[model samples]
Target: MSDEAAGRRPSIRDVARLADVSHQTVSRVINNHPSIRPETRERVLQVMSDLQYRPNRAARALVTSRSQTIGILSSSSTQYGPASSIAAIEAAARERGYWVSTANIEPRDPSSIAAGLAHLMAQSVEGLVVIAPQMRVFRALAAQPLDIPYVTLQSTELDPTHALSVDQMAGARLATRHLIELGHRHIYHLAGPQDWIEAEGRMRGFLEEMSASDIPTTAPILGDWTAEFGYYAGRELLRVRDFTAVFSSNDQMALGLIHAIRDEGLDVPGDISIVGFDDIPESAHFWPPLTTVRQDFAELGRRCVDVLLGPVGDSAPVPATIVPELLVRSSTSAPRPL
Candidate 1:
């Protein structure tokens, strides 16, 4: 072997010298930059192959001050929607050769949210994706303004440039409208907790749809997005059979509601029709199959990464919005003949 071949590991300059190219051109090729001429790139790559050269990530990051890492701040990571979205975000980031740092905020308090943010910041993330669902989370995020570009997965009038949303409101409206069209004049809404952004959107949609149809809107029962809550709400509802149908904010609650109604010797669609949101995997297998609205969590996650890496790098923010679709099933039907 030649003395040069026997020398220490090859560097960018070594590859550049052998390929008769500038070190900058070599760097561009290493980074897969688009501007390098095809022939030049191929020659540089061949030289690199001959030298067994590998670009040093640490050196590049030190020079760029970019970890090539993104942070994810998720408040409801355990839930199906947020969990699925986070997975998709990770997958998308992987495809782009980016690292993901995740922080799960379990508490709604200001301290917890701040701590979560601080944790991600410590990782030296170049950008952030916030999957915060609660209104309080938005408040907490605002309290500590972030220096790095970030994207929020919520729909609100505030900070439109940094927000991406799935039309939770429209999904709710579709669910309620389905019941209305089925000739059910009286309907109840099972809403998510008061402070959750998604819950608020779903509730607002239900109200708007009910008002538009000239149907009297019964007060919605606030649920904790659990089947237990649904079961309890169902039991209590047995005392007063005021509505012909119920629209739940999520499938989990709908599951509980179904159990409760069945325990009370009531037949779904036969006595009280039902609808739900977030058509989780189990929704299709629910006792009678749940009619629900589906949100493309995967698509939403992909968009979050795209927007963050795009205009965000240019210091220009672009918001992304996706709509939801309603799925009809056996859970809903026209009210029994009066």
Candidate 2:
């Protein structure tokens, strides 16, 4: 039963040798210490990958109390936007040799949110990534006593220190303005549920842009961030058929709207131009190729890990809000001559 009679597994020294690094440097890399050089880090990672080396989490925790884990608190959502954010966070965490513990909760239920937080805390998570789309989630989280570093994926700007998010308002404005500049005076907005922070921010952006342009507005159709809801809303909107365009809050809803429009024998852009937010992968493949706003979910994920740990070195740049881009395609066009 003694080690002398058994074979030894790969050790830090073995990795150092193959990586052409000192054991100290290997330790720094394993711990994800900020002081390690990028080139050295990459080289060590490659060597470890080639050797199929995995750090002993239990052994490391015994010595350094470093679990090498991050926790994610997310609301249950099938919507592409929130789901993509969660996937991005997990991928980013794994790239740095960290494990992710995710706890899903209902954003509207304070008790559920509290329970989720308590569960993550019990694991002694080093940091937290909160995918809180609803304002109520923030309220619930703010009431908790948190000691670990936490970053929220939201544009609320309630806490500049702990908040990191895509500029939802700016992205919404980009979509809305695209419609206005197309000479479409009569336009509608299909917005998400009013309680959600992202939904509110986007709706605000749409209204602001419309008001600034001196464009008269009808009340936006609040949706459930579902393609089904978008379809139903589109059907209702076409009853009057007065508007020449619509800006959907997310791509799923836009797809629904597209379906409804086609059901009524209407053409996208030929009669009613459509614009959408959150350029999910399929957005690019929609019938006319969706004209939508593109969010850098992958970058947001990387920034979450980076901000949680802070800058790597003195010269490293701090993480900032990611700007969304507008993608124009066949889905939109200038209004037809009256």
Candidate 3:
């Protein structure tokens, strides 16, 4: 019978009875004791589900003094990069038998950051994952050192000790080098917003590569990391076919650039080659497919958890940087024999 039908909420005792295990075993399963047999854990979990048993976090905390939860503090949670990282963290946490609580706040406001941290602290989270894309957020975190362990997804010498990140600059350099190697000396760059750490890193990489090749360049068109900006930028750049290639800081802008090129009756890699960053899912299916950099967000997420919580049963040292990969697709090619 359902717990509702029984006229009382099911208890740990009820779960132990149904699963044919002792109450102690049930408690171990509840607390994610690593030594429990797989079959026994499954049986206990099944029974808990069948009885609609919800462990009282309050009572559990009182007894064990461990909340067994991880808090995620994100500033740009709505963006693809931050969102992907968050999903990866949640999956890794689940594998370790832990829960995740996320708090999103405006990165610019110190008060908002304080409030967000406070909200997470109230849950007694064992650790924290800070997805602070903005430098100010990291500065705020530095000012108020966290009581529990925390990890940040930043690499700009801001907090290298506690940082777990993909080498964004390296990824950008790879993209720029590909275009230059393709024999396209006249290359333009579509960069993200000025203040964003990622945008700055990518622009710097692009500039470094261009300068290293002894290629003179014009100012890059600053973009908002949107298809709309890319489209307009592409349209404006097309007015004078001065450049044979353009490297976009992100895929959305590349998509817009592609659309603008097609609208002008031009071709990708034929009239101009395009390369983008962040191989979002739809990039592969774009008209000619986008050539871009792929950030291993899933692995990044795993490392995020491992740094603060340590590997569940393994002993792998946390890496300084998870290098991104360049995905060369149909969007780029040698600038049509000059």
Off by over 4 Å in 3: 1-51
**Reference-based lDDT, each prediction:** 0.87, 0.87, 0.90
Name the regions of candidate 1 deviating beyond 4 angstroms: 1-60, 311-319
Kindly list the per-residue Cα lDDT of model 2 for residues 64-159, writing each as its tens digit.
777788999989556688788888888989888788888999886899999999988777788998887787788777789788888888844665
Writing each residue's lDDT as its tens digit, candidate 1 over 1-338 gives 34875688888888888899999999889877899999999999999999888878667766567778899998899888888889989988887779788998865578888999999887678889988888778876777989998988874565577888898889999999999999999899999999888999999999999999988887889999999999999899878887789999999999999999999898998999999999899999998999999998877877888887773345544447789999998999989853
**Candidate that beats the other on TM-score, 1 or 3, i.e. the better one:** 3
Output the worst ten-in-a-row residue range by lDDT, candidate 1.
310-319
Query: Could you estimate the TM-score for every candidate?
Result: 0.81, 0.82, 0.86
Where does candidate 3 clash, by residue pair? none
Error of 3 at 43 (Å): 15
Report lDDT (Cα) of residue 102, candidate 3. 99
lDDT of 1: 0.87
Highest lDDT against the true fold, candidate: 3
